[model samples]
Target: MGVATTWHGTTILGVLRDGVVAVAGDGQVTAGDVVLKHRARKIRPLFDGHVVAGFAGAVADALTLFDKFEQHLKAWDGDLRRAAVELAREWRTDRYLRRLEAQLLVGDPGQLLLLSGEGDVIEPDDGVAAIGTGGPYAAAAARALLRHTGLTAPQIARAAMQVAADLCIYTNDQVTLITVPPERQEYEADDR
Candidate 1:
């Protein structure tokens, strides 16, 4: 709110399959035509490990929204849908929050949702969601993998992020993934 934060360049993807959910994010940040950071983490657990969220946009703005959403989660008693909806509503209508340039992909074991400043809280029909520069590619890849491959949710998420990193200039192979329906554990692809 004090100073406008720079836009964060990266990719984040989420997948839900067979009662499990996984989220992955690339670790690259760029400014203008120059790369700034190579290991920024964009996905995190919230509400006492019940929900996982990945964000794309200004890092400060995203963190602010994340903190607010955490409060919403607490207020809603860890209800993912309610917390997401309330965050979206506030982001859409609140004077300051409406200016945040960020999009959120949040989920639990059974649900994946996308929240935006436009007051949209969407549940992906195919249990796949993505945000950031490489979002479309990752989402499409995950959808295809879900439809045609026997990969688990975590596998699909990691693969999709890898696919995104290959195609999107802003995205990279330094991916961080987390799975739900079991306890959260971090997974990284090859570390290249």
Candidate 2:
């Protein structure tokens, strides 16, 4: 959206295992066959709070959605699960949204949420979900991390970043992570 327009890809991933979650993305973004940029953070902090989101195309669109989603959440004092579901529902039925140019993966302190217009507010009981470049790889890594260690929020985020790092999927500055611990998750971003 600035000096760099490298935020498209086909390898973003996320995983949920043993009640823990980890999501990862590659550093490379492609527009058709051309790599547009590197080290972009597909995974991002939403509402500047505990909820996190990641996407794999049309960076601007994804960001716009996040902004509106966050505002809706705040406006209603909404729960993550319900808010996510509502957003997905809207995205799915709205005439204009029916053609969103990107895919979105959203998560918060209490649960992991994925919205693809296939369904909304889906809380994966299996403990995992993901979207974007290097997604499969990240999902695999998350499963491995979950199996080996019943990770906490920070641990999950760290694991996701580690997996993305190995694939040269992210840049040093582009990767960032945060978490919301169960009860304290709701006001996560604004807690400080």
Candidate 3:
């Protein structure tokens, strides 16, 4: 079943595999039955391109969260998990932020996380997650692809977003993607 979205139409998903992580989003903005815009980018690179993030909700609110999250990233010295957690805590406890209806999928080469206004910071067990109107379908498609095929992280993310667009009326095929590739030094013991 498709989830209900009042006016914000979006589908955002991410996948992590073999040291590669990617996030993808569909660009469709709707107001009830009306399609307002197409090609509205929802996926973006953050922290000097070290992290990637996607969002689903009111565009204004999502932008606000993005700015706040960026500050958290700076404060944490680019720690993805810590930045996400701080953002979640603020989103949940700050009354003004609590009223913002949005969800974030963020990651680096080594991790993928989901943050919500409910003070939740989640790391999917399978290194795949989704949010927005077509989130479930996209998530399921990514999981299936991950289990049955050897698609690269970006390929899997893009394909799953396409499936979501086909199934979710709120989503469209105009997809954008951002990825982080593995570096050899990241695997070194001293690097960790």
Candidate 4:
């Protein structure tokens, strides 16, 4: 058998604070030890921009999953939790989806969830979740920032991504952040 190609690079983080939810992702895609691309956008606004989602793993696989998730969102009338659960169930059971190697972090105004191909839909108790090679570092930094500072959700997500980039060779400094503001509240403008 031929050697398996390992896809690496990417750090995705989600943080919910003060009624706002933010998801951030670093822009680096690597194949084995070689860097293939920079400025890859792994974070996307879904369901008419009512939710933000980010992914880590093979780019094609993640994109496929994103499309599937959006369909579920539409079917569920933009209910994030239901859409996430349905996606997780299908991802675990469907033959093609079961083979996908990717993880998703999705967030809306009221919820933040991590979905896996293993039939897992996890909602973090601390309102922070992360995935990919630098996930742990990002999660730790975000937790500290959430506890010690009054920064907004977007700020915490960006800062935590920066920390992960600084520590993980697989992650880069270029980040894309998307946020879903609290229900009935206007979206906050930030310098991107």
lDDT computed for candidate 3 = 0.87
lDDT of 4 by residue, 127-157 (tens): 9999999999999999999999999998898
**Backbone N/Cα/C clashes per model:** 0, 18, 0, 0
TM-score (C-alpha) between model 1 and the true structure: 0.92
Give the 10-residue window scoring lowest on summed lDDT in candidate 1. 183-192
Q: Please, what is the whole-model Cα lDDT of each candidate in the order they appear?
A: 0.88, 0.58, 0.87, 0.89
For model 2, where is the 10-residue window of minimal lDDT? 183-192
Per-residue CA lDDT of candidate 2, range 9-119, in tens? 544444544343444444555664576565555665666555666676676777767776787677658566767777777878887766776777776545777777655
lDDT of 1 by residue, 1-192 (tens): 576545546799999998888999998989867787888889988877788998999878999999999999999998999999999998999999999988888999879999999999999889999999999999999999999999999989988988898888899988898777655487553333
lDDT of 1 at 71: 98
**Which candidate, 3 or 4, would have the higher TM-score against the true structure?**
4
TM-score of 2: 0.71
* Native RMSD of candidate 1 (Å): 3.5
Worst 10 residues of 4 by lDDT: 183-192
TM-scores of the models, in the order given: 0.92, 0.71, 0.90, 0.92
Residue 70, model 4, lDDT: 100
Error of 3 at 184 (Å): 18
Off by over 4 Å in 3: 1-5, 182-192
